[model samples]
Target: MRANSKEQIIEAAGVVFERYGFKKTTMDDIAYAAGKGKSSLYYYFKNKEEVFEAVVAHEAEHLVNEINASINVSKPAVEKLRSYVNIRMKRFVQRGNLATALNDNFLATFSFIEKIRNNYRDIEIDMIGEIIKEGIEKNEFKPVDTNFIAEAILTCMIGFEVPLLTKSNATDESVEKINNVIDMFFYGICT
Candidate 1:
């Protein structure tokens, strides 16, 4: 199949998969959703799983690129980490389905989504570890378990998004709470 055809199917699949969800959606559903025939879908994707993976992978790549670009190596470690959190939350809003799938239902099962999530997460963690290394070099962030600290910060960022999708824009109070949590991550609450 042509590159454009494959991309169209993936784009269509993203909308259909999110609208109908991963389980209820079928190949015919995606084909019809794409305005193409079932054979065309099959020509591009072997199964529903392949289409879903393509959609998720596309979102993941987009997010990684956005976050990576926003990270400034020149900044202080904590400042870099702060920008990382803000950029990540913005992407969470933009990613829509993969974010919803990872944070919401998706047939109430997330092993497949979790695997995809970890693939993206590992990069963020690695980038954070690099910042930690930089901090250690400059005597900024304490020289502790960088990997564990990175994991903690990443978890906090994901936690911030967990409730926002369900609200009419989660309240200022909720945003305040999550920001407080994130701030504690960058700097200890006590001066």
Candidate 2:
């Protein structure tokens, strides 16, 4: 099926892109990995960018799904936040190269990532915003600008992928570091 061919090419692209990054990856590289002639590959995907887009979509959607599945709204915000962070890191590692490529080529990869990010952005923000609202309503957190605070928490998550793979400290320690930074943001050191 052409759909299957598309999937194959996309997976192969993930491998090549991850190994060589966006600038270095070529259509020939993807075709070879996909076990097709470069022209045949073009028959399925217009170019490497199309293949790369497919991989990015698959990997990012997977990560968001895993994070959503792991989050338990019934739990307190603190525990929910912890689970959120854990799920995101775990999913990224599970995704490996696809994950690496997504981060590595964020600015330069297929514009598809921006589209995907835009599509998912609201859902992600709403998820965090809801929790912040609930915590405030429950008196678990002091009343503050929920939206801005939610955005702040989301901003802190920016560090998750970068440090986990590159940091000298144990992976578990990064979670501690994340928690400390989050704690400081939510509850200042004055206490």
Candidate 3:
């Protein structure tokens, strides 16, 4: 077995956790996956919880980086918001470990999971709020409470997670539904 780096351990642990979940997974499983001894795992992390936290943090950081990159384009605020929604939804599904960590009720047993989720939630709200503020300043969108609208959009996103994860073929139909919802958010229902 190679001398596994901490990142390697975390990456391996993510796979193990995704396969067996937080409770069912053990240090041995992570070690085997990382091609390291169980003792080597301890050198980097105190326990499975620490490893799992690292994995979640890694995934969350990756998601934030992608979101920031996608939204930093020269497009209008409306396009930035649309890009945010598309990337967030797409990545949320594609990143299995993060999705499992956030969506699985069982993982809620880890208290840190809630903290990580709350941190991500706050970041999401702030980013959306900025986009809304930009939209209002440019008169691309009507003046509204940015925080309220951001929170509302986040709530809708949270509502979409479970159903999207459950469906066997969710991508196309889900994207259409999400776009429809965005259009409704932009345009009034009275039409």
Candidate 4:
């Protein structure tokens, strides 16, 4: 079926792209990985760029789903926020393709990346804003601008990612640092 073949190609392409990265990967590479001829790839995707975009979108969607699944709605807002950050950071380090997509150099080279980044930001903002709103409604958190706080938390997380990416491995120290920062966010330093 056309749908199955297309999904097969995207799935294969994700592996190739993860291995070779976008700049080094070619149509032949993806086609070979997919166990199809190069022409078959052309039928489904206009070019390598389109294929790469699909791969990035696919991986991102997977991560978002994982994050959403890990959040327990019955839990307190603080725990929900903590769980979201822990799972997000842990997975970001674990998923090679995702790390590549978020890499600054990869982002700078692809025009399509801007749209993906913006879409991701919108999703994060909405998710975090909802949690913050819920916290306020339950009197767990002080009243504040939910959108602004959510945006700030998103910004902080992005800042955290840079340090994690630089290291050859994500050390426990790094994760501990993240936990400490999150703790600071939830409970101020003065106390």
Per-model root-mean-square deviation over C-alphas: 2.6, 3.3, 2.3, 1.6
For residues 169-190, write the lDDT of model 1, one tens digit per residue: 5545454665688677667789
Q: What is the per-residue lDDT of model 3 for residues 1-191, given as tens digits with 9 covering 90 to 100? A: 33348878988888898888788999999999988899988987898888988898888888889989999888899789889988888876674778877887877888988987888889999999999998999899999989998998888887888778877368667766877787788886776
Minimum summed lDDT over a 10-residue window in model 2 is located at 93-102
lDDT, residue 79, candidate 2: 69
Off by over 4 Å in 2: 37-40, 90-123, 137-139
The C-alpha TM-scores of every prediction are 0.83, 0.76, 0.92, 0.92
Model 2 earns a TM-score of 0.76
Query: What's the true lDDT of residue 93 in model 1?
Result: 55
How many collisions between residues are there in candidate 1?
0
**C-alpha lDDT of candidate 1 relative to the true structure:** 0.75
lDDT (Cα, tens digit) per residue for candidate 2, span 1-191: 88888788878888887788777889988889989888878786776667777787777677677777766547887667777767665555454554555466654345666665665556667777877787788888898887887777767776676777665355677777778877886689995
Better of 2 and 4 by lDDT: 4
Cα deviation of 175 in candidate 4 (Å)?
A: 2.7
Q: Supply candidate 1's per-residue lDDT for 131.
A: 78
What are the lDDT scores of the predictions, listed in order? 0.75, 0.72, 0.85, 0.81
Candidate 4 lDDT by residue in tens digits, 20-86: 8788999999999999999999997899988988887888888788878867458888888888888
